[model samples]
Target: MSTFHLKIIAYDKIFYDDEAASVVLPAIDGEVQILTNHEECVVALKTGEVRIGTPKGEMIPAVCGSGFAEVTSDNQVEILVDTIERPEEIDIRRAKEAKERAEERLLQHKSRMEYYRNTTSLARAMARLKEANKYRH
Candidate 1:
């Protein structure tokens, strides 16, 4: 089977670096599937889950914040995101607290700017919690 090298990096760390048979990323517009030597392109990423299929047939899943992905014609895929976390690494309690805080802020803040920030935070926290729980088994 054909495979490609995939590197996923965040601001503070490298989340993954390995050979993958395929990858499904949450693009800003929608979900995108990438395979070996697919194409050369760049796309914005939304806050969601990224699923990677390894050569050994293992599936690795990660939660990613907003970012971008670059795909090369030579089968190199680089994903740079604001934040990335594995399911096991995430603290469900912390994510829940963050979500509550954001919700509180959303209710108390009347300014549009504050509302937007709180809304985004709430969305991100919810995404993290949901993704983390999905892999708890």
Candidate 2:
């Protein structure tokens, strides 16, 4: 199977740097999949799940915060995001609290920017909780 260099860099650390067969992540329009030798372009990402298919046939799942991805001409994909966490790394209680806080913020009147921020926070928290639940044994 063909593979490409995939590097995922979160704000706190480098999450992944290795060869991958494919990657599916949340783009602004929706989910987008990238394979080896895909057309070079930069894509804006939203808060959602990211599934990486490795060369060894493992599907690695993660939740990611807002950011962008760059597909280079040399068969390399680089993702820079505000945050990324594997399902096992997620703190369910903390995510629930964040979701509640964001929901409370939504109920109050606020500036447009504040509203948007709260919504984004809500989305991120929801995504984290969903991913964590899906992987729970």
Candidate 3:
């Protein structure tokens, strides 16, 4: 069995740090899975779920804002995002409110920059809501 050092960090805190067997990240193109000794490269992440597989084969689920990840040649994966929230940590009511607020702002016909900001907010909010509700069913 093989593994890699994985670190997930955000502005406020470190979400995770340990050795993992694999990780699945949400990329703009699509979901990407990185295994131990995977290719060394940088990947841009989107507002979606991040799945981590530990050495013991336990799966962890989380959601994060748009960010980037760097994979070192020596089997080190570092993910830096603005914010990361585990499913259990997310406030579903707050996320729903955020989604509604972003939707309302989009309808106001703001400037281009404002539109982009609202759009990003909506995406992030939706992502969080989806993650929070995933285990409910």
Q: What would you estimate as the lDDT of candidate 1?
A: 0.92
For candidate 3, what is the TM-score?
0.97
Between prediction 1 and prediction 3, which has the larger TM-score? Answer: 3
Task: Please provide TM-scores, in order, for all candidate models, with all chains considered together.
Answer: 0.94, 0.98, 0.97
Per-residue lDDT of model 3, residues 20-120, tens digit only: 99999999899999999899999999889999999888999999999999999999999999889889998899999999999999999989999999999
Global CA lDDT of candidate 3, please? 0.94
What digit string (tens of lDDT, one per residue) describes model 2 on residues 9-121? Answer: 99899999999999998999999999999999999999999999999999999999999999999999999999999999999999999999999999997999999999999
True-structure RMSD for candidate 2: 0.7
**How many pairs in model 3 have backbone atoms within 3 A of each other, for residues 3 or more apart or on separate chains, i.e. clashes?**
0
> Per-residue alpha-carbon lDDT of model 1 for 23-133, expressed as tens digits?
999997889999999889998998899999999989999899999999998889999999999889999999999999999999896899989888889988999999999
Model 1 RMSD, rounded to 1 decimal:
1.1
In model 1, how large is the Cα lDDT of residue 82?
Answer: 94
Which candidate should be chosen as best, given lDDT against the real structure?
2
Q: After superposing candidate 2 on the true structure, give the runs of residues whose Cα lies further than 4 Å from its correct spot.
A: none
In order of TM-score, best first, we have 2, 3, 1
